[model samples]
Target: MSSENRTAGSGRLLTGLAWAVLLLGLWLWGREITDGSESGSSAPTTGDVAAVGRPPGVALPAAHKPLKPAKPQRVDVPSIGVTAPVVARGLDTQGAIEPPPYETPHTVGWYGNGIEPGAPGTALFVGHVDTETKPAVFYGLSAAKPGERIRVTRADGTIAVFTIDDVQVFKRDRFDAQKAYGPRDKSRAELRLITCGGAFDRKTRGYTANVVVSAYLTGVAEPRAG
Candidate 1:
């Protein structure tokens, strides 16, 4: 081969080698990330529903009757001025809750094994505030405060009213799953709202804290007979 042709061939070989190295590095980096567990960084903290220990904020006797599904249709709280649609589902892998569909727009997560809203015990709901991709449904949840009036309208055209007792923020790892799932005063069913909060980690692209809203059912609408 002539000198110029030989030089051109060498250049192509170098380019191919560089591309191979780049692909190898990317694969190694992805493997390390997937194999490494994300522990310690997600320990639940105060304000987490899990913080509710054997002695909860307010504990009562076992539920009088087993919980039944009250499938909610709409939710309204005069206190925070939130009137959103209700969508209820089971838990997600991350353990954060989802929200119902409202004009505001967001997925509301529900507890699969817990009491259904309008049931005889506490019901649970959760949603995300913001992810790296999109903002979650419960993004405005932090704005809620105590003494707020919350109302949920069911598919049956019945409305259930709840009073916001308080709001708290807990670390991801310190989240108390038990407290979130435990029964409340037992007089009326309750609802707990959850979402990501606290410090934001750019590296992990997630919130270190979780916001929880504790509310109790004040009134339940009687179902209409078929």
Candidate 2:
């Protein structure tokens, strides 16, 4: 995965005061929004939505209302052929929400310390785009278009379904941690699937941007038996 680019900055560049300053810029990297999570922010206008390499919203389904809280156990993005475990993770010492380790590239990391999936607020799920030797769970995530369904199974016998809203690829320098990680409409349940994308820099061995698949709660279903 393009860790360096998504996180933005070489370890050497982000040191001492500069590192703290960098962290300050990426305040949302902490994604600890709870009691103070904003509500009812204006929705993004068509003009406000930015598109990168691929077009957004290809075959998306009808939007569904938000549901009650359910502890997500796993996530599946059929459009991307992804079905991976969702593990809880927190911010690192560098103040960035850590991704699943390279060794567990296929696993997805949920900001467990923050909002629960299908609940009001933004539930973040991150996965590796690639590993040193091969592609990871979200390697094809950037290609996800509208109309696709993302299902997250909870500990209970339920699944929270989210529909693709639009895809945004934020450059490392332009990434807005708060805006990107927070719920757009405070009353709604939103989901963000993030991975590294854009050009892969051989120097850093990471991508130059982050591919964020923005989605909203659309439907729920009974858990399927294995």
Candidate 3:
């Protein structure tokens, strides 16, 4: 793996129909990351007041540890104040990991055929950066930083805590699907929060890059449910 992290910039450009088709074709078998887009860095207002946005500076965390398998239910990122439901998604007719429908813009989709979130592998989770009317669940993902916590509430009633390690925005033409989706730590429980990012080219009617937020499981907890 390369020991470099690339900083990102820019915003959304996908049209309604194009966005839908692109997202649906994202997970095609043996395919790499082809397209995505999102808004520029913005302060998070979803979690606690103290959980404001931080710069994605030169920071790294300890190696992530792997854990037993568990089905995911929801995801919470307090630093960015993101709390959203998760839905299991499989490949579409075109053999791509289908994305959540546009109507359910706030929901995220996890690859159902892949390893579970807490398992000993990189669990892939994705969401739309925006819609025709507004930003989606992952709209603010560009603001995440290393060492922040990403909590995944599972069906077993336990929460899998992952620590952010890196965030990168790869240009569409330079995007590497295998490298982007492959496990950096094969034995550790890792996570990648992906969305569209980078400059929006009005001429192409699409985003010029994709935002990737990489993290790994550090611990597990059983917090009381409200």
Best by lDDT: 3
Candidates sorted on lDDT, descending? 3, 2, 1
Candidate 1 lDDT: 0.50
Candidate that would win on TM-score? 2
TM-score: model 3 vs. ground truth: 0.75
Off by over 4 Å in 2: 1-25, 29-63
lDDT of 2 by residue, 1-226 (tens): 3444345444311121122223432565454443325310011222333453234435545556667676789999998689999998776675566667656878988876667788887788877766544567777887787667899999876899888776776565565666556567777788988776556555654455666788888888997679
Ten consecutive residues with minimal summed lDDT in candidate 1?
34-43
- Per-residue CA lDDT of model 1 for 28-137, tens digit only, reads 24434212120001223444343322224443223223234567766665654455556655323432222333333354545444556767666666554543334445
Q: Which residue pairs does candidate 3 place in steric collision?
A: 32-177, 33-177, 36-196, 37-196, 37-197, 38-196, 38-197, 46-81, 47-81
Can you give the TM-score per candidate against the true fold? 0.58, 0.76, 0.75
Worst 10 residues of 3 by lDDT: 1-10
The total of clashing pairs for model 1 equals: 22
Cα lDDT of all candidates, in order?
0.50, 0.65, 0.67
Superposed by TM-score, candidate 1 places the C-alpha of residue 105 at a distance from the truth, in angstroms, of 4.3
